[model samples]
Target: MDESRPTPATPPAVLADHAERMEKLLDRLLSPQTLCDEIARPERLRAAMAHGLLGGGKRLRPFLVEQSAALFHANTDAVLRVGAALECVHCYSLIHDDLPAMDDDDLRRGRPTVHRAFDEATAILAGDALLTLAFDIVSSDETDLPPTRKLALVAGLSRAAGIGGMVGGQMRDLEAEKTDRPLAIRDIEMLQSMKTGALLRYACEAGAIAAGASGDERARLRRFGEIVGLSFQLADDLLDLTSDTATTGKATGKDAAANKATLPSLHGIDWTTARLRDLVVEATDLLDPFGSKADILVQTARYIAFRDR
Candidate 1:
């Protein structure tokens, strides 16, 4: 079912002003070739890696990182590396999620999935490479952050992407797939939080942490992350139901066929839509402490739920 075009709720004017700064930062950080063509076998793997990683994603996670870093008055050049590093991890997850043994997706951000574009084995290794490469980028000397701050960001990302976070949630989702079990709304929330929200939270929090934010600021940022994170996942669920393959760049209605647990599956579309609105509102409220600095984050949260593609 195609939903009507969503309103283009732009990010706050403050954030909009820094769009060029963030773009420059992203360009600088991600400019390096991920492929080290020095070795022959690694070259082939790098090609597959580039194919998946270079695709045009919404770049939402990186945007969160850049915006959060800006809150602490962090230098754009110094903090943009964190954004690039987060993209590496996000790309890795998508590669794995599109694997044959996983979602078995033939398409990603409007192109063939890594496995389909390349081969299954290459796709698996490409994901592994990106995953490890993210840590390398964060911990590298080129990061331009203080040693202590860099270490904290690295540890936080490790925890968020490892067994305690995304991986654990994936296990829960896979187990739920073969069972006759029914999940409560709270349980569904937890699952989505861990599966999708973990990295997003990390993206926001780590940016603030890297910028040497105050304890109060970090606490507020965490709350903001939670709300926006949930909103992001809910938006994804809504898109699966309402977006077409042409716009989404992936097969529509995969969740229904896979019997995946989603907000719309647990509750009707109306309820899910209402819940998304509430989440976005709550997310926007969390940004009040940051004053005008958080306008972009707040507006972006509302845009997530309202976006159709």
Candidate 2:
């Protein structure tokens, strides 16, 4: 080990601190007072939006954005704004995913889902509002990035969240449920990459884009993001099979209940566990060139793969 390299240990407290800061940032961003002119802000709509957007999670996507940007020495405030925008998109997906017409979930992050807490129509509108708000946040003056960088961020996020990405993947998932035939491993991988991996890949790439990193550096983080994304979904499937709603703060075993063909369901727990470990190794190795500056991300990869919830 080089004497100048920073220690590799990244305590859980570091992640906790990041989460705490993200929570405050999200709260401020979602607040009605920060949204629009008093006359334009609707109370009920804002309330519904708050119910979903303010709901708690680990804020891992935003953390990825911020941390990845730090690698290239991007502006902190601009990076955080981009992170917040990404989070809005994530929250929107969760809200819509929980609706009756979709996964029909009733709980999320330990409370009533937006539809159950409010109404289905309101929930739908809230999700739409959040999705649009994300673009606004990125394009608006508050983000403080150059026009070119903002444009790049906007385009990247659109592709990640749009029909060819998360939306398309979701459609594939739903279509798969309707058919009796099980998905091939390659098909499953592609669907998972689109549905869950796109945003994550973009999160790291966004950092590089924000900092004007070379194409090689951007590609490196993009690969890292892809590895982390796979590990994230695999771990989630494992938790769904092994953990309960009390532990996960949401419905458990839904994949099995829905007869969804997750990798764990097909390949079994032992295989999934080993795969996750391998993915973490691959992700960390991709960051080795960054030295100790990548330690937090290495820790993040482990946390994503092995987190209990």
Candidate 3:
């Protein structure tokens, strides 16, 4: 530990601290209120961009990156920027997910969807800008990682958010809506793993890359990320099924209405609940090697399983 740098925080404190820090970092990254009149930028586009990104959410993906990086004693400054970049990807996804052609959402984070708040064209552009900016953020010298590590992070995020991951998952979801038969378990798993799990796995993998962890160590963290990703989707499915729009800050019951395939949709509530608990155990077991240093990451898995949104 360096003399000037603070000591590692306790688990609860670290989670809270990371949340606050990430929010600030995101605010700086996504704040549209500061754009100048002297530029060639569209004011509405910037506003829509801000509207989508600045809306309150737990920012869970970035937290995974931050906490996972800490487990390896990686540079905090680098992790903060990397976390912010990951957030850009997440916010972009939400914007696109709410578009009329996609989920047809009217609300997000208890407010109007980006397309509703501005217009569909602006919303689409905002998502595009955010998606591209994520790469820009990660590529900058400010992230402070070596070139190899930065390249790895960039490549991983692209794959996670592009055709191989979230985007591909979204396409699958849309196709499923037209089907008469429900998706099989394997299909649902593959879909959710691509749509949601890919980014999460990237978050943990980004941490390992930033820290220059050994391949085997990164492998363990990647497993933890995968479990967390599945747990996240399960909890999200449960929330959509049980929590009202007011509680979740987004439209609830949309999955059923849209006929989207999910584990809870197929297995029912009890099975989903039990499965989430088992995932928590499995995720915790993966962290046995890190012991006390993993306390916050462990709590993060719990939070994902039990979060209100």
For each candidate in the order shown, give its overall lDDT on alpha carbons: 0.77, 0.86, 0.83
Q: Candidate 2 — what's its lDDT?
A: 0.86
Candidate with maximal lDDT: 2
lDDT of 3 at 44: 75
lDDT of 3 by residue, 1-309 (tens): 543222222235566667788878777765544333436667677778788887477677888898888889985888888988888899899999999888888977678999998889999999998888889889986678889989988988888888989899989888877789889999999998998899999899888888889999899989999999998898889888888988767779978887777788788877887788789799899998999999888888877786766
lDDT of 2 by residue, 1-309 (tens): 443221233335576777788888878987768988888888888888889888577788888988898888775888888988999999999999999999898888668999999999999999999999999999999888889999999999999999999989889888887899889988999999999999999988888888888889989988999898998898889889888888767779988887778898889878887787789789988999999988888988888888877
| Cα error, candidate 3, residue 46 (Å) | 2.4
lDDT ranking from best candidate downward: 2, 3, 1
Count clashing residue pairs per candidate.
0, 0, 0
Residue 157 in model 1: lDDT:
91
**Candidate 3 runs further than 4 Å off:** 1-13, 31-40, 242-253
Candidate 1, pairs of clashing residues: none
How do all models score by TM-score?
A: 0.86, 0.92, 0.88
Candidate 2 root-mean-square deviation in Å: 4.5
lDDT of 1 at 43: 66
Ranking according to TM-score, highest score first: 2, 3, 1
- Which candidate model has the greater lDDT, 2 or 3? 2
Instruction: Give me candidate 2's TM-score against the actual structure.
Output: 0.92
